[model samples]
Target chain A: MRVALDILIWVLFAFVIIGAIPVAAGAYQFLLIPFHSFKNHYSKARPHLPRVAVLLPAWNEGAVIGNSIERLVKLSYPAGRLRIYVVDDASTDDTPDVVLGKAAKYPGMVFHLRRQKGGEGKAHTLNHGITHLLADDWMEALLIMDADVIYREDSLRRMTSHLGDPKVGAVTAYIAEGSADPNYLTRFIAFEYVAAQKASRRAQNVLGALACLAGGAQLHSRENLLAIGGRIDTSSLAEDTFTTFNTQLGGRKVVFEPHAVVLAEEPGSIGALWKQRLRWARGNVQLTQRFHKVWFRPSKVHRLGSISFGLFWFTTFLLPVAMILSSIGLIGLYFLERELASTVFRVSWFLSACTYVFLTLYTIFLDGPTGRRSWREALLFPGIISLLVMIMAFAPGSLDHWLPGLFGLQVTEVGQEIWTLSVYAWLSLSMVAAWLVKKVESTRIGRMLSPLLIYFVGYGALLCAITFDSYIKEFQGAAQVWDKTEKTGRVAA
Target chain B: MSGVHRPGVVRAERVTGVSALTGLDQAELSQGEATDRALTDEALWREIAHNRRAELRLVPEALLALLVVAGLIILREVYFR
Candidate 1:
């Protein structure tokens, strides 16, 4: 019995180490980001403008479609070379009428492609337009974008120029959450984009393995599109990611153009954000299973199967699992060997604290305007309580000393032990808090409380909770329904 | 290429008499020529120079961030100990 207990303890430690690996890998990815300036594909890119077709998939986007069409017409690309194809997905709104009006105003430049049957999903809608565009040779390159995204004047031109390199398959722009008056949720999203797109994508560029192209701003060369079955993958919820992987697997480079900016309206409330992110999280789960054979098996054809890429992918996909496992490990250790558990907890969280500080600071430095706007969200990304835990982890008795003093109470041994145990359980407890944040958003008093709950639980934790929910849904074989994030024309150029 | 006849595509009015390959008409040929002229070797070099400058600017900022992180680690080790 003693020997068996010892082995169980060792296994718990192994789980803790497993959880720490991803955090270290994430920091390592950030370290590689600075190397992007040296190891980018800029030299091979030249000034080349192909005849571009902008495919806009619309489903009840009448409120934003007119303005979107107007913006496309005013883009800084050559008017003769650019054409807008609004693929109306049988929208019951005034989308068709608005698009037809634009088509009349900008003849030959703006075309309305109506689909009689609709609600199939974005991929099917895109494929409809793709079939029409590929039938003729007029479209040398295709730009697939959402109806509500406002592209910067030179964004398309920059994306097209990258296609000058025949070796390059696709280009994706940095999508910034540009709600005219951003609330707490949008601010968090803005910071998240800064970290995900501006920092992580740059790192991926250096590593030469992009995970996904932005759905709002993906530009693909005609030859490359045709090479990958002449249509978008309608099988997965993450069609953009499917296309991205297929493009790279077929031996062509997919580049992220940071200079090319596109503004998009993100979910403003917790309930809305949950629905939108659940779809994405579920899509990622599907993609992981679909490409199970490809992980960690390096291929000469593509880097999708490379060890670094696989680590990045699996770490993100299984982060919630890692968190739960790590918490279990620490708590088990505390029961069996208290002193060792304390030592391990301190060492592990010290590394986590260091990583959090460096990553948050470096992300702020990545984009000037976004950094300025969302710096507070970036700082409190892990939540106020988690940040305190980080501080306590590294500086062992500091919180115990200061927190009790702040409350004007003496810290007893029993209180200290309870606090220690609570800290150990916080890794998993944070996710519970995050789950409550979503639940609270739907209540009568939730509108007032949800935003406050998000701050206390942390947006990162909320995302992790959603991902955890995705695992449950996928396990139960829940029906994959495409939930459209409703957009109010909140984005300004 | 002359007209739209695809299934489910209700309305598409395409401009005819233009080269499908080049996508330029007779009237727009001058405009295309001007665009081509603007994309000269010198212009390409100028853009490259701007990009290089931007990239060079990042090196110091990254180094500074690393230094600050290093300082933080030192503070934790010294003061917390």
Candidate 2:
């Protein structure tokens, strides 16, 4: 009982430490931004708006690029001042043909460029555009955008206004769901976007630890970008994170301008949304590993301000541990020691409830006064999904093998390939366990939680096996890459 | 580098020696130059060689890092104790 009590107190202390980080994060919404907003007002005392380049990277956007370009071109900036560069990454469709057609319509307004045929993907395309195409002196401000995104006409002006302050490296405008009538999956994700952008992005900005600017539509200076590195890490799957980290590494502040808004379309169907989010999660996992060196050993300039990037994804792997602890707290409450169990149960519930509330409120706060989210709606997000959504998002896909293969090799193989013989053993036990545990909550839930213990920790162990076994591989030292999600939802009338 | 405006009426800005790709004078390369140059199919692009190391650009991302460290320190001091 004495040893158990000691362990119990230690566990509670761990929970408090874990919960406090985000609570400190939440303090940003209530306290930091308002203060920073005022500081921004003061910085405006001497303004210097550089000529801005709205760089929208697109491939096969024939249907939407026209409108997206027109909307951006018509932005309130001086007529020719706001230039639009759309990198056509070797699309098989009439993307280049369509772009040529638009270039005729908006003669000097829209600039059309193409990537080398075999050398495709956003990072390579961006690197090619920035280095070979543009003379560094001229490309002052750059806006990174997906092909399907649309933006307010005044968006450029507001973003440029902030650039006048030399300290601001990158500015991310508010990204909202372009289609309200999107599928249910899209709707839930849309709310999540608003919450994420407002609460998490806002909190991150306050803490000065912004990991990446949104890829949809964000503005940065060319000179400043080149100073750190021209086009962010082209090798990493997550170019957005690479840019965000580099921007912070440059010691330039990244800001979220709520007033500056853009409408970006997201995947509408379940299959499509899964692909989209999986790419995001996997890309996050990949980038976290790639930039772990920078994040873990951040230079003096951006020590704490930069950790949130790694922290966000790194902590995700810990969610399962936290949930298991919660389960333990409940089990202890039920059978162990009534008083001690009550304490553990109440304490766990309180810490978790507080985290849930604060995270929800921070997101709702980003909704501004007219946000669609209510206190209740935000409260039951994960619970209402009944953990199915959690499994869908977290469960490692069979497709992870394809990811490393995309760079041209299967050498650094993990789990599936590495544990082939071990897998046979585990497979037999898993099948038996599945048959026995059908009535218990869910098998998918088990898959979700099981991988947390495995994902980074297990993936790492498997990679070590590959190296030790001298596994034959492809793409020797090339960066492992993943596919960008195709946005299927179209703008409906 | 994907957003490209459709090629409408190709209007060269009646200049002597500008890029024939767009033919527009003072056509900043960031928009057309980068896109137009990326037309090659087999060029092996090198990642930015690390010749430059945070050479004190206008805004230092380092200050942001320092701010983060300072913030962490403050958090630990205030709460961990």
Candidate 3:
């Protein structure tokens, strides 16, 4: 019986170590990102701009459609060369009218096509637009853009600059959250985009395999598009991912152009963010289902089979599930035996913490001047990662003893396993506090306190809660449909 | 409306359209259902196999797990005993 019990403890300990693999791998990847700066692959600039068609898919996007059209009009590309196609997906609102208004003003430059029966989804709408564009082969390339995303004046030029390379199939730009006075949720998204796009995607680029092109800011060469079937896959929730993989599967490179920045309005509320992230999470799960063969036995023909891409993609979909299970298992083991569990937990955490510290410094270094200025955010990153690791390792309720003592309150539960749910729930208020302080930032106190809360719990714990919920939903195989994030046109041009 | 026990009959409707710009008729192309790649039992099993294979490839991860577990065992032997 004692031997059996020992075996059980060992098994649980193994689970904890296995679960930390994703986090360790993730930190390692971030650490490697900065090294890519020295190895630059420079492609010569094109002598002249390619004739490009911008495909905008809209469904009930009346709020930001006009602004989007205006932004497209102001793009640095030649008006004679670039054509904007606004494909209205049977929007019940005034979306068609707005496009028609723009079409009337721009005449031949801007065109409108409406899908008679709508809700066919973004991929189908894009296909409809592609069919229209294919009728005239005058366009050399196409840009698949979301209606709410606004490209900076030079962003289009930068994104297409890489298309000069004959081997490059598609180029994706960084999509930054663009609310002028962003709330806490948007601010978190802002920091996340910097890490994901500016850091991670750049790292992937060094390996010649990018994970996925941003659906909002993808530019595909006309030849490359036709090579991998003219239409986007309508069956998958992640049509963009399918397109990205297909582009690579057809023996072409999809490059991430970090200089090209597109401003997009992300969801502002937790509920909205949850729905959006759930759809994204489910799409990733579906991608794994669809491309299991690609990962299992990657052929030389399929460039998406690279180790870097596979590691990022699989960990993204599976880590949260593993973390939750390992955490619970650790808690159970702790209840059975105390010192044995503590020693193992501390050792594992020490290794994870060192990785986190290295990753945080590397991320800040890669981020350049702006990142350095926001050192507060960078400093909080290690703490955030450590706290998350602790929570996932079933941090004892005694951990809260530190917090209560610091706040001068009595601790209620000692040495009990504290489920992170309550901690996250209570900590979510920092998001509110950050938003409130930001709103009142004209005052002295607001200016001093807002950035701290914004970086600490507002960005950190709130994001974890949303991510944890997404993992739970995906694990349960919950029915997921694309939930359009509401855009209020608060983003500046 | 009174109903009796009778053979159930189902009716189907066909819809088609021609694009004004491209002049291409839909026929069955647009109307037909997209490929149903719904996660099947076979596909799920295949995915499980794929993940298992992936685990075999993760030698470093396996080593990390073993080392950590071994540490705990040693700690138990040294201190608790």
Candidate 4:
């Protein structure tokens, strides 16, 4: 029995180590960002502006469609070579009117295509445009974009230039959250994008295994699109990811153009953000199953199956599971061996603290303007409670001393033991806190308290909670409903 | 045409018997010349230079971050123990 318990303790420690892998992977990804200059495909890129067709899929986007079209028309590409096609997904609003008006105004540059039967999904709408564009020989490249996003003047030119390299199939731009008057939620999202899109995608470029193209700012060469069946994948919720994987699997390179900036209006509330990310999380779950054979199975065709890429993918996919398992391991160890549990907790969290500091600083340096604006959000990404836990890990017993001293109290042995156990349990408790943040957001005082709850629980924890929910929904075979995030024209020109 | 005027090049023709052109004409000429300058060899080289400089700047910062992390770990090991 003693030997068995010892073996179980060692197994628990292994789970703690497993949880640290994703944190280490995140830091590693950021460390790879500077090397992008050497490994990127820019050497093969040139200023090649093909006859480009911009596909905007709109479903009742009247509020933003007109402004979006105006911005597309004013893009710095040659006026003759660029065209806009807005696929109206049977919008009940004045979307068709706005689009038709723009079509009339821009004449040859803008055209409106309507679907008599709509509400199927974004993929179906995008396919409708793809079919129409492919029917003609005029378009040499296709730019897939959301209706609410505003492209910078030189963005299209920068993106299309990569098509100059015949081997490059697709290009994705840096998508910045562009809510003009961003609240707390948008700021958090903005900082998250700086990390996810700007910093992480740069690392992906170096690895030569892009996980997914930005759904709102993907540009594809016509030949490459036709090679991948000429239409978007309508079966999965993650059509963009499917297309990205298919493009790479077909023996072509997908490049991330950091200079090409697209501004998108992200969700402004917790409920809204939850819905948006839940869809994404579910899609990721679907994709993981769909491409089960591709992971960790190296192929001559693509690097999607490479060990490094697979680690990055699975680490992110299984992060919530890892967090729960780590907590369980620590708690189990505590019952068997208290000293060992304490040491393991300190070591794991110490690694997490290092990752937290390195990634926050590196992300800030990656984009100065966004770094300046969302620095607060960046700092509090792991949540205030997690931050305290990190501090406690860094300086063992310091929090016990300082926190009690602040309240003019002494720490008893029992209280200290309980506190230690609480810290061990916090790994999973943070996810619970995150779910409570969503619950609070739906309450009468949601608008007032939810943001505060988020700061206390942390945005990263919130995302993990959403991913956990996705795992449940997928396991239970929930119906895949296309929940479109309502867009307000908050993006600045 | 043989010496100065190439197929894709535009040369000044001593307008108003003066070698120097007016500001408006120069501006117009620069606008036409801009197309040639777009994404030229010099521009691509400039982009490469910028990337190199960015990489150089980042290396020191990344190194400093590494040192900080190492310092924290060392401090915990030495002081806490």
Residue-wise lDDT of candidate 3 within A1-493, one digit each (tens)? 9999889888877877766677777765664554444432333323224667999999988999999999998776545557899999999999999999999998977999999988767888999999988786666789999999999876876666567567788989988778876765565576677778877886787667778899999999888989988889887678898899889888888888666779998876655665676666667767888888788455687556767667777766665555555565556567777676666665666555455545555544444553544565555643353455443433333355556577787744542335333332232333344335445555677556655544554454444445555656767877656677787887766
Model 3 alpha-carbon drift over 4 Å, by segment? A44-48, A296-298, A364-480, B1-81
What is the C-alpha lDDT profile of model 2 across A72-184, one tens digit per residue? 76565444345677788877777788778878888866788887572356777776667653464445677778878878765655565556566777788778776746543
Cα RMSD (angstroms) for every candidate in the order listed: 5.0, 16.2, 15.6, 5.9
> Candidate 4: deviation at residue A30, Å?
1.8
* lDDT of each residue in A1-493, candidate 1, tens digit only: 9999999999999888887887898898888888877888777766566678999999999999999999988776667778999999999999999999999999989999999999999999999999999988778789999999999877887777678778899999999999999999999999999889988998899889999999999999888999999999887789999999999999999999888899999999988998998889889999999988889999998989988889899899999999988899999999998988888888889898888988888888888788898888888888888889889987877896888899899978888788888888888999999888788788889889887777878898999999999999999999888899999899978
User: Which candidate model has the greater TM-score, 1 or 4?
Assistant: 1
Judging by TM-score against the true structure, name the best candidate.
1
DockQ comparisons of all candidates to the true complex: 0.18, 0.02, 0.01, 0.14
Worst 10 residues of 2 chain A by lDDT: A465-474
Candidate 4: clashing pairs of residues: none
Better of 2 and 3 by TM-score: 3
The DockQ leader among the candidates is: 1
TM-score of chain A of 3: 0.84
Clashing pairs in 3: none
lDDT scores of the candidates, listed in order: 0.85, 0.51, 0.66, 0.84
Model 1 residue A71 lDDT? 91
Residue A177, candidate 2: C-alpha displacement in angstroms: 1.4
Off by over 4 Å in 4: B1-56, B71-81
lDDT of 4 by residue, A1-493 (tens): 9898779988998988888889889887888977875777767765465668999999999999999999988776556567899999999999999999999998988999999999889999999999999897778789999999999977887787677778889999999999988999999999999889888888888888999999999999888999999999999889999999999999999999888899999999888888889989999999999999999999998889999899889899999999998999999889888888888888889889999988888888778899899999999999999999998888887786789999999888899889878888887999998898898787788778988888988999999999999999999989888899999899988
As for lDDT, the candidate ahead, 3 or 4, is 4
